[model samples]
Target: MFKLGSKSDADILKSISPSMKVLSSREAKLILRVMDECIHQIEIVSFFPSLLENPEPFTKSLGENLLRTLKEHQELEERHKCLVLDGSHDQTNSQVALSAKAVQDSFRKIVRILRGTAEALRSKETQCAEDIVKMRDGLCELREIVLERLLTSPGEEKQLREMVLEVSQSHAANQVLIDSLEKDLAMAVKDKDEEQLRSTLQQKEKALQEFVGRTQQDAEKQTHSDQKTSEGKRARLQQEASQLNSQINNLIAANREAEVELRKKKYKEETEIENVIQKYDVEMGEKQTELEEMIKMHETDQTELRELEELYDVLDVEYSQIMEERQKAQELKELQEKELEIQSKAATVIQALWRGFCTRKALKSSAKSKKAKKGKGKKKK
Candidate 1:
């Protein structure tokens, strides 16, 4: 039964041969129309590495293969152009027409192969770009790890930790999206929905590609901004350090000068103090000599005072003896004056008695004579 089915299919193909030949000719023309497009796509794919900062080996190898294919395609195009030019000369020959048709058929096949190769190269280019982005992400992660190890500031370390956590979350989200897209693709394949399957696949791939591109662009922008900021901070810090060093140098110079001046002042003060002490010592020596002379003079004056006191006592005794002698002489003179007065009064009394006695003697003598005579005269009287 299978053989019969196969035989019937072959018979049906034989009946369609003429129509298929016509269709093939039309397809040939169509292929010609698309040939330039395929070549342009190949060219675009071959040039893709130019946009990359660091292309991988796979991309380089694929680009080389694309270049080789493009060169072959160009050679084939040149041959086709030559054949078209020669077609006029062979216009009368059926054999030449058959050969030309065969050549066209071969060119169509080659064009198809080049188109497939170009598509493959384009897919590879996209994949290469994705891989490069992944590698850059890995390097960034490593850099973060190294920075975490080297970082001392708590704020910067915390910022880096948060960034790492965010990157991890984003990666997880991407993984979940990929898994969901893959499941949808599996479901589409199981249902044999070619259109839906193709569209879903294209959408997923485009979304993923766009997401990767956006991620790369954002990362690059952030890295560039961070680099600019770090450079500015470093320059400012260097300027501040320079200023501080200059200020420190100035302060050190000032301190040294102040120390020198202090030392000079201290020495001058010490010298002045020593001179004052020496002057005081000289005055003290002079005062000590004067005190010693005053003490000697005081001792001599004390001895003279003792001698004067003795002389005063002797003079007092002599004055008392002279006063006693004066009293005795005055008593002697008063007694002599009284004796002289007594002698004078006795002499006057003696003289008066003598005169009376003499008178009495004379009178008696005369009375006796007169008695003799007056007995006669009798009294002569």
Candidate 2:
């Protein structure tokens, strides 16, 4: 509901998020064809966390693509993490292996997640939505800049917001290219990464500076144009629509001319798809030959999840016991410390009383000796 950026989080979630997938007849067939590949890719993608840690084997774009795939895969895994097995689907036998059907039943949600993720990857609107996050980061920097310059005017602040948005705008991701000329860094001493990265930064900096230089001129033009009346805007829109309609007509005519060619292309594609399906059927059948009953994958993950939960419970109980023991030990130490303090105080008081008694005895003995000496002197007199 909050309108901080172009798309609110709730709206973006609604737009990009996939609903729960049911196993439709067409999708079920498609799943059977690609079931083996799905399992293989899922297992391989499990190691993607490591690839994400070290994406040196691929380009930045490929790395990002891999990350998106892994996230969908993780979501797919989440659907299978239930305590009870979902064996609700009727045992309908089809050309697809029984095992594949089982997997489909357990993971009916996979196709939707993958389709949604793939669609998001392809769409520019999704990318623009992602830029909102980058813009939010830029907003933090803007705040810091404003706080640094306490005397910023309203006009300056508006310009700063525009500047931040411009900076935060997504640029092309082509920083890393395999350089055959440069020696392998693994073999040689590693130079500064910034030194290698500086070229890309410099290019982007130059582009940003040029854009900033042109913006004021462009703004002045836009300001003048924005003064146009509603009638003028409607006229301009009508003219643009007319030009677009003519372009569409030309495209339609060209498409009609290519109809026969398109049919041929479609036939070829169908042949290729059938061939691939035959190959995949053989491969998938062999791999899933042992798997007859459905939800083996789900059961395996469920078992693992249960084991982990049990382990966590055991660890938690042990931790609680240790904490209890530690508390008892601490209480005992405090009790001993209090006892030692009481003993020390008692010893101090006893020593003070003993010292006072010794002083009094010495004083009384000195006074008696003085009195006896005075008596002897008086008798002599």
Candidate 3:
């Protein structure tokens, strides 16, 4: 809309928007140019004749508001810088200062409410750092206790006693914090310094120190007492172990004596067992003699049985040979019957042939005589 052909105050302000969203020098230059053009347009509208008057007093009122808003923005920037300085640490001072400068520059374009909110965030960051410091100290104390327990609670009860002394020293240190806090509170109220709001904070710190001191003392006393008890118990256990060792030696001696008696008893039982075994061996020898006689009888019976088996084998061979001869005789009988049947068939065939030839010759002679008679009759006629 702010093309060169129709450049106007409103169009320039509209163009200034995108530049305002950016926080670079270029945006700042564009904003300055827009402000100048708006002021020029105000002058032209108020005094010049051709352009219609802006009866709403837009340019003058907007310029005044912008100026006021910019002043408020700058004030917020200063307040944020002060808060950051109050909270800055040796570790974060340089980097935080640089960041605060950038934030101040950007705040020039921001509205007052947003700048106030940023200040609140910085205050919260300050409180967070303070709380982190307190928590770190508390954890350090806890770690001391844990390390003392783990590293010191062995072999040397005197070391544990010294740790209890250190704990008392730390408690005295807490009393020092309480004294310092009381002095700070007294000075803060007497000086009428509203901004020195550390009294309540100091009170809280003092109270935390008191609580930590009491708890640490209680833990120290308990641990020292436990260490003493453990020492006593260790001594008792050593005494008990010595007594057990003595008892074990006496018991070992008694066991050796009992073992000697057991050995004598076992030797006596072994001699008695040897006598019984000799008797059983004599009985076994007599039984063995009887068994040998029975075995001789069994050998004779077995020889007779083997001879019977041989006789049966011979009989089986002779029976098989006779059955073979009988089979040959049956086969010869079949051959003879077949030869008789063939001879009878040949004799019957020869007799049938002779009978047929005689009958045929007689028939031929009779037919020839008849023929001769017929021929003689014809000749006589």
Best by lDDT: 1
Which candidate number has the best TM-score? 3
Clashing pairs in 3: none
User: How many steric clashes between backbone atoms does each model show?
Assistant: 1, 0, 0
Off by over 4 Å in 1: 1-277, 341-376, 379-381
Per-candidate local distance difference test: 0.66, 0.60, 0.63
Q: Write down the RMSD of candidate 1 (Cα, Å).
A: 57.0
TM-score of each: 0.25, 0.26, 0.28
The C-alpha RMSD of each candidate to the native structure, in angstroms, is 57.0, 45.9, 36.6
Model 3: number of clashes?
0
Per-residue CA lDDT of model 1 for 71-93, tens digit only, reads 45455556655666776656555
Query: Given candidate 1, what's the lDDT at residue 151?
Result: 33
Ordered by TM-score, highest first, the candidates read 3, 2, 1
Q: What is the lDDT of candidate 1?
A: 0.66
| Backbone clashes counted, model 1 | 1
Across 1-381, the per-residue lDDT of candidate 2 in tens digits comes to 112345445654543333424334564446444644444344333333443344444334344654565455454444443312444654334523544545464344434434434323333122223445455455555644433343344555565566446434421111122242245764354556667678879999999999998998998888778867666989999999999999999999999879979999999999999999999999999778647434687788899999999999999999999999999999999999999999999999999999999999999999999999999999999
